[model samples]
Target: MNAQAKPSLLAKFGDRYAVDPNKMFETLKATAFKQRDGSAPSNEQMMALLVVADQYRLNPFTREIYAFPDKQNGIVPVVGVDGWSRIINGHPEFDGMEFRYSDALVTPPGASAPSHEWVECVMYRKDRGRPIVVREYLDEVYRAPFKEGMKGPWQTHTKRFLRHKAMIQCARLAFGFVGIFDEDEAGRIAEQSERDMGAAQVVREQAKALPACPEEQIEKYAAVVESGQRPAEQIISMLQTRYELTPGQRSALLEVATTQGDQA
Candidate 1:
């Protein structure tokens, strides 16, 4: 008898969610993962999304867990408000939660909205029997509108946003949830990642345009790298000031620098 065929990643994922894998993927592409660059999600990215979904027991069809394409062609898993509520409530140890608001309200300069002084979240766990308290300052957690004269949710629902921030922070402290972020945090991380990628690309292009290192200077630099005297980064910066080093030369220097140790 022939052995049972191994199910594909999508097939397995579909089984978990009790949906048709092909249809689910198509739906996810159309609805959930509309990349900022307008590119379709790659299969690997989809697989990764499924993995995180399964790990978190989130329902993508319900918009619980979603993703954005990040730099280096990866995905940043983002949980929705509903998703956060689900995880916090569904956790076995979770018992109950409460909130406290500060009496004072202050509007930061250039902000169109006035926010509470702070919001505090007190979370209870069945196992611990102690409440975890987290206080989120409105000024510290507040995000202004992306453009002037525009009213984002932060501007419109400042108090609600503050409460959400407090609850999320408290949840992290209570549940130790890692490797997932809310939409706001994910957006900031994705933006920073893109900026870093752009900076790296510019550096690579600039390095390529530089003139090749002179052969005579190779031994001097090799000795310098092997000496373990200064940091490898500092030595590279000193060399790059004069000439361009190829990837091989850079790798060799790094290898020597790492291996020489204090014995050098």
Candidate 2:
């Protein structure tokens, strides 16, 4: 197929490439809230997020998470395929090098989408560490893949494919931060699965029958069910300080509690 007519490279991998957005958000939040004294993962983390978004055909909004030494000449938050490639390969052109994501947690407001976030990393000259101007490459300049016998050397082709796979996996995991599979649809499907297996009805009935148990017995049972340890007499004694319960209700409570314990 011609370059413009070719399917997205990401689509060939399968649906597993898609990410749960909610989970992605949670992971991003956790990473951002971590202590700031440590070094940040910056490029690696951003690459992972992009990989997932690309696989899912989701467009993430780029927000600046941070600008080192202020934005005038520093690296700023950016996105798109080129940005991801630059971070991963550490080169603007396909130079046959391999790269891996780092494990640093960067502070946020560096760049965030409705679903994920990223921190900015300053680009510096290798020898002097002097800042370099970050520029966005135009689509034409990057050269459409498979065009004009423009393929890189054999090593570059192999390494690029490998890196793309790695990015897809990382993106899948990062997608969890955004609640991708945590929606009502997933919940409904889970409930349906349980019902199909005859588990949901049993649990519902057990819960409904729990209220007739005696307060003391129910408290003892609840404690054991919740904590995996039998309640002490003192713990049981404290039950009467609160609400009342009936003997049958206590029996039901014990059944429900025991059932829950079994599940746990």
Winning model by lDDT = 1
Model 2: CA > 4 A from native? 1-167, 172-201, 210-244, 247-264
- How much does candidate 1 score in TM-score? 0.71
All candidates: TM-score: 0.71, 0.18
RMSD of each: 7.0, 22.3
In Å, residue 236's CA in model 2 sits off its true spot by 5.0
Give the alpha carbon lDDT tens digit for every residue of 48-77 in model 2.
544555544444433212111111211222
Model 1, span 199-226: residue lDDT tens: 9999888877889987666667778777
lDDT for model 1: 0.82
- Among the numbered candidates, top TM-score falls to 1
Off by over 4 Å in 1: 1-13, 36-38, 109-112, 201-264
Clashes of each: 0, 34
Candidate 2: global Cα-lDDT?
A: 0.37
